[model samples]
Target: MAIKAKNLSFSYRKKKVLENLNFEIKDGEFIAILGPNGAGKTTLLKCILGLLKVEGEILVFGKDPSTCKKILEMISYVPQKSTLSTDLPITVIDVLRMNSKELNEEIIEDFELCDKMKTLFRELSGGFQQRVLIARALMKNPKMILLDEPFNGVDVLSQEKITKILEKVNATVLAVVHNINPIIHAVDRVMLLNRELIAFGKPNDVFTKENLFKAYKAEIPVVICEEGIIHPLYGDQHG
Candidate 1:
């Protein structure tokens, strides 16, 4: 297993954020975490990243992430694009170079950032900026990658490209996303949350109307595409 959580729970200022988030993530599995804002989606990611001390246990590849420093080296984390500063005068190459002495030309080309190598990071469009962050996340070639709101400010084209890149990685991926359409086809499973684990299974199994309603506390519509993919029709859920 890439990750295993047992009786996982967390609180902030004495208020519960996540509760009993027991789940197992297989190696190389691509998992998408869906939930409304403040539902502890990002909080869960932090727990897995060992940035928070919760009430239960979380293990990454059989090692306790909270206690094992080496386990952290096997993981890479990408924060939401909105949380990152876009006013920096850094260049794309320089930003990527910060993580590794030798750059991965393949990633720059795959993310279509070759031409923007010399451009000031702050001057790029929202889509390109997100791509840069994701590309930088790959610099370490980690065994597992955690992403928070990767598609938040990305355009359709960039979203598609990002999804493709993520699908090709030979590693475990866990992403927190408010909007799931961008990754619906690529993800192997879905973990719906509402301050708890609403459901965890394949898209077709977990994205039922009832599950969506439970997670969002709203009647979000769900449709099955011709390819038999479960697609949820909703914008960002703020509540």
Candidate 2:
């Protein structure tokens, strides 16, 4: 198992954020976490990454993620684009070199960041910046990867590109995504969370109208298309 959580729970001061979250992720599985804005989706990722103190147990690769140094090294993380400093005077190559010594030129070219190697990170577009972040994470050659909103704030073209890149990554990936439309086919399973585990299964099983309504606390419209069932993008408007 890449990750296992039992009776997991978290709180901020007095209010609880996550409660009794139980799940397991197998090796090389691409799971997409779907939830509303305050659904503790990011909080759950932090717990798995060992960045937060929780009430229950979480095992990443059969060890406690919070205390195991080896587990930390085996994981790579790409935070949400909002967390990054847009004014920082860093280059694409500089970011990659910060975490890895051996430069994987292939990743740079694959992400279409080869031309921006010398450009300041702040000057690049949001889509390019996200690609650079993904490249930096890949440079670590980790066994598991955690991405928070990998496609947020990017154009449709960039979303398609990132989705394709994710499909080729040979690792267990747990990504927090705003919409499933872009990565519906790339992910192996879908996990709907709202301070609790709402539903977890294949995309066809979990992305139903009932499950989405329960997670979002509102009626979510779902449409069946030639590709598959498509759910409306859950955002602040729904909340």
Candidate 3:
């Protein structure tokens, strides 16, 4: 297994976020975390990454991130675009170079930033920046990746391209994205979180109207069509 969480729980100061969460992730698997805002999705990721103090047994390939020093270098993170500082006087390559340490031809092409290597990060669009962060994450040659809202402001075309690249990688992925339309077909399982693990299974099994209602406290309008069941989270829950 690439990752495992047992009885995982966390709190922000005194406000409880996650409560007794348990799950397992296999190697080379793509897992998408689904939840409403402030549902402890990002907090759970942070706990696994050892970014925050968490109370539970979190084993990243059987290693604790807090005690194991090299554990951190084995993973890469592509933070939300909104979390990035656009005003920073940094270049496209600068962010990649930070982790890469060494420049290579493949890096230039994979990120498609050879031309904009010198361009200011603030000047380029959001999609390009997402690619840059992904490239930077790969620099460490990690076995896993943690992405938070990776496509927040990316264009449709760019979103499509990045999805392909992520799948091509051999690393296991734990991503938190808003619109899963781009990766719905690519993911192996969906982990629904809301202070606790609501469900963890294949999208077809766990992404049901009942479970959606349990997790979001809202009914996701689903359409029965020739393609398949299309469920959308739009309407309020029936009280």
Instruction: Assess each prediction's global lDDT (C-alpha) against the native.
Output: 0.89, 0.87, 0.81
lDDT of 3: 0.81
Question: What is candidate 3's lDDT per residue for 52-136, written digit by digit as tens?
Answer: 7788888888888867768788888887777777899999878888777887667569768889989998998889888888888
Q: Write model 2 residue lDDT over 28-115, tens digit each, in one string.
A: 9999998988889999989988989989999999999888867878889999988888788887788888779898989988998878
Each prediction's number of clashing residue pairs: 0, 0, 0
Q: Identify the candidate with maximal TM-score.
A: 1
| Model 1 residue pairs with clashes | none
C-alpha TM-scores of all predictions: 0.97, 0.96, 0.92
Question: Which of the two candidates, 1 or 2, achieves a greater TM-score against the reference?
Answer: 1
Can you list the residue pairs that collide in candidate 3? none
Per-residue lDDT, model 1, residue 228, is 88
Worst 10 residues of 2 by lDDT: 230-239
